[model samples]
Target: PDFKPLPKTNQSVGIDLGITDFAILSDGRKVDNQRFTTKMEQKLKREQRKLSRRYEQAKKDNRDVRECKNYQKQRMKVARLHERVAFQREDFLNKRSTELIRHYDPICIENLNAKGMLKNHKLAKAIRDVSWSMFIEKLMYKAKWYGRNIVKIDRFYPSSQLCYVCGHRDGKKSLEIREWTCPACHTPLDRDVNASRNILAEGLRLFETTQP
Candidate 1:
């Protein structure tokens, strides 16, 4: 039996990127952090310890050469772990991007300059998890393959601080305030969700304005 064709429609979406949350959809849906890269932190530390011990033992024995079979095995083990972590991160990004492309058309996201964004010491991990640059890369290629659109708006669009329901912009909210009711509409605001909605709207407006 043949499968039905996928429907094509402009489904305006906003991807609010973060570390703990990864990406938030305009409709309040969340794609949790993959953390594949982070999952190896502990293991990597332990592996380092083992390598350290091996090196210490070699030094104590005054062996100018430590390329013994055991030493080679230990080095190979560390390399394998590094390889695994890289593969996991790639797999996570590919799967997540593909899912988003399949589900939504005209996916809108911020065009973030991640190198500058990562300079904030407080938001480093959160920024990394969002993986804005990697996500955008995957999103663009996948959208192209799927015949969908990936819309990128300015990073200063204020998606998070703007009230999507009332178009009221709050330029003063600190990053600490995760949830706040919109002063204008009294709507309970989810920082991530609200930002996503704003992103979606802004992207839609941009798309329509550019339409012939």
Candidate 2:
């Protein structure tokens, strides 16, 4: 099947991806983190436990585990549960990416080192559950297919630490500080939204300079 390029739109957006919220847009819209893995964790654990019990029973009966019908059934149940979670995550990402590509001409986002971020034990699970890398991959491919542009700002760009209104460097801030007033411009800022706006501004600047 042929896929025609989508019509161009004047709208552009910057997205700040986070564990708390899936994405915060420069337009002040937030898409909630669905946390599909977390939601299915308890059910998956239960199925896995059942699978283990089936394996143990097979061992006790001197039955070949591979040929044990009960064990195989339980194993399939556990596998299906895992597949469900994966499918749910993929569906959410696809819908969101398609919507963004259709509506926005150029989508801006930060270049995050997802692998490096996973090194933090405290945040690793949440980060993996969100599947930021998968989401970005979807956005990239969709953008190309739909004639939309996707801009990734530098990882060290300090989108959060800088004030979007006045470009004042606020230095480092803990994640706990979700809102702050910019000293330079005295403007109140929402952390994710502020970062998104800055990303948009920086992305446009870079895009313009690179254009022929």
Cα lDDT, all candidates? 0.81, 0.93
Task: For residues 43-80, write the lDDT of model 1, one tens digit per residue.
Answer: 98898788778877877887743565566677789999
Q: Give per-residue lDDT, candidate 1, residue 120.
A: 90
Q: What is the TM-score of each candidate against the true structure?
A: 0.89, 0.96
Q: Estimate, for each residue in 48-91, the C-alpha lDDT of model 2 and write its tens digit.
A: 98899989998999999999988998898898999989999999
Model 1 TM-score is 0.89
Which stretches of candidate 2 lie above 4 Å from their native place? none
RMSD of candidates 1 onward, in order: 3.3, 1.2
TM-score winner:
2
Instruction: Give candidate 1's root-mean-square deviation (CA, Å).
Output: 3.3
lDDT of 1: 0.81
